[model samples]
Target: MSMPGLSTGTIAARLNRMPITRLHFRMIVALSLIFLFELGDLNTFSYATPGLIKYWNLSVSSVGVIVSASFFGMFLGAWLGGWFSDLVGRRKALIWSTAFYSIMSLVNAFTTDTTELATVRFLTGIGMQAMSVTGLTYISEMFPKDVRGRYLPESPRWLEIKGRSQEAEKILNDLETEVETYLGRSLPEMRDFEPVQQSAKVPVAELFSKELRKRTIVLSLAWIFVILGFYGFSAWVPTLLVQHGYSVVKSLNYSFIISLGAVPGALLAWPITDRFGRKQSLFVIMFIVAFCVIMYGLAFNETTVIIFGFLTAMLLQTQTALLYSYSPEIFPTRIRSVGTGFTGGLGRLGNVAGGLLVAAIFNAFGYAAVFIYVAAAFLMGGFLIGIFGERTAKRALETISK
Candidate 1:
């Protein structure tokens, strides 16, 4: 299974030295479109819940159940998706998840009852979560370091981990040859950096070994709390505003305005992630989200509420962009997908709890109590990462694990 004049190490060396080309940009854009549609489908519940509640005369608890159902599926989906990615391949995992979710989403549009909708949403959740985990894992494996020696190394390093050096070599050579064709020049020869491939597969239990235990615990907690805070706020913003005396239309309008902040926030986090490091950036953004959300709760006027709401949305997106990038970087190549899946899967617990908590709290104590709870969740997530997170800005994934 050898390719002439190609090895895993040589592939990595060549890929690392090649420039970011149109091919890379196009692939990222394609992936982004998939992410966009997935996000759109996932968020439909929040927007449609009010109408469903009125039409069905659903109780708060029932609404909460509908909201939380997908999260349970997400929990299982993420874990299994990670395992699938590691066992089968990223492309196949991604394709299956995408196809499954797309069909489920169409079915969801035709649901006639809350129970039916909830069931469809749960199935869609599994596909959506699995796709997300696979996407993050794939990107980390495919991309080279953004800053020399500061981010993930090329895919060859990870391919070598799975004893797929031949495939690794082919991928790298294919990428380099494509780029070379575009550039009308040959890539420079370089020495390989990967060690020889190992024969054994990485076990899931290895993520909890003595070396990664603390990181695993910290990351699990952080994911749970961060996701709790993020989904809690985003899922209920419009409803919370309505409860605060704004008309339903006004509440929806404000939510739309604030949601627009996500695009800029994502754009802004890119350079900041490479410059300030993932952990610190996440801490600052989450802390800001806490502040802004608290302020949003206290605002008496539309102008103030809109301003704070926009700020909160922006900062939350900033934190999310970093979180997605940081999650997979903390593990070694052998178990990257598994570790990512496990942590992310646990975060769905928070998502489920957060939705239920928000409904219970809003029903009893009102919007202020909800924000206070959300603020605490964000602050706690910030504290965990700030105190214990590793510095992974300018280092290889393998180096960071040690």
Candidate 2:
């Protein structure tokens, strides 16, 4: 039997109607496993820094260098990765990035000197951002049009803009077939949305056109501050606990307790985001994080410290969920990867500054100074997004970009 041709809207409708199955479960599980390894490597320095200090008899300046090194690489990686994803393919970009970072991380674990470690970490950082940005772009590109439904959509705009209509239609048909196979029935007919016009060619400079310039700038600054706040505080949380008069082992244990909060925060963010909209919800979350950080700095009791610390971690993770979903929507499909990469790369400068700033303050002042700096970053991030970020809830990606 010949399969009937369908429109992008029909493909999206079929995908949205899919029921839970082992195939979906497997895909989610695979991504989760990859994320676990990546996150562990990303956070390794946070746990290792104190021990590295003792083992290497390191100075605060050296610690700052080690921490900032990866971010420098990340800056390069994100931009290049974005370009690569556009030029080649998302899957290849993701695979190459994953392999590069994973290998570098393993090499870094055995390094005996700060110089060697920093060098390896820099390379690893490149892979980290590349893998992350490529993966995110892939997810956005792979899905069907979200329309009024909760599921995210595939960029028909992107497909049309790139002159890939046939491929796009094929994807929709394949998805419809899969859903039909699962349901053991045919899908209901759907009216096709008018396909977007295809440009002869799209220049990268389209990202900076008058229509998009303001959005580009706002997202860039927002990302910078968000990364600054996250890396500044979380990277040093264990070390901060140690400075607060706890043993190193106890500090690690306390950090673990704080880490547990991230789970619930992530679980809660998805559903709640639709109600408040991305811009407003991010503002509230960041506001709460700043307040929690301030309280964490002032709290002298262990119980008080743990409570506020947990809240801060949870809120920060939630902010992360919102930020990622929000950021990519601001750009059209043609430059989506590059736009995301550019902002993410620009934001990574905050990570570089954050590490050095934390070291300087901790050396000259104390833990309180570091918290103040991080709190300020979070506050600024919130303000920028709340004031200028687009409301992306329940909107199509193509429409949002325009």
Query: What's each prediction's clash count?
Result: 2, 6
TM-score versus the correct structure, for each prediction: 0.92, 0.90
What would the per-residue lDDT of candidate 1 be over residues 100-191, giving only the tens digit for each residue? 87898789889888889889889988888889898887776666655431221235555666677667776776777788898888765554
RMSD of each: 3.1, 3.2
Candidate 1 backbone clash number: 2
Runs in model 2 lying further than 4 Å from the true structure: 1-26, 144-161, 184-202
Best by TM-score: 1
Which regions of candidate 1 are displaced past 4 Å? 1-12, 147-158, 181-202
Residues 85-200, candidate 2: write the lDDT tens digits. 76655667777888888898899878989899899889988988888787677555454434221222233345545666686676556655777788889765543333343454
What's the true lDDT of residue 89 in model 2?
56
lDDT for position 215 in model 1: 85
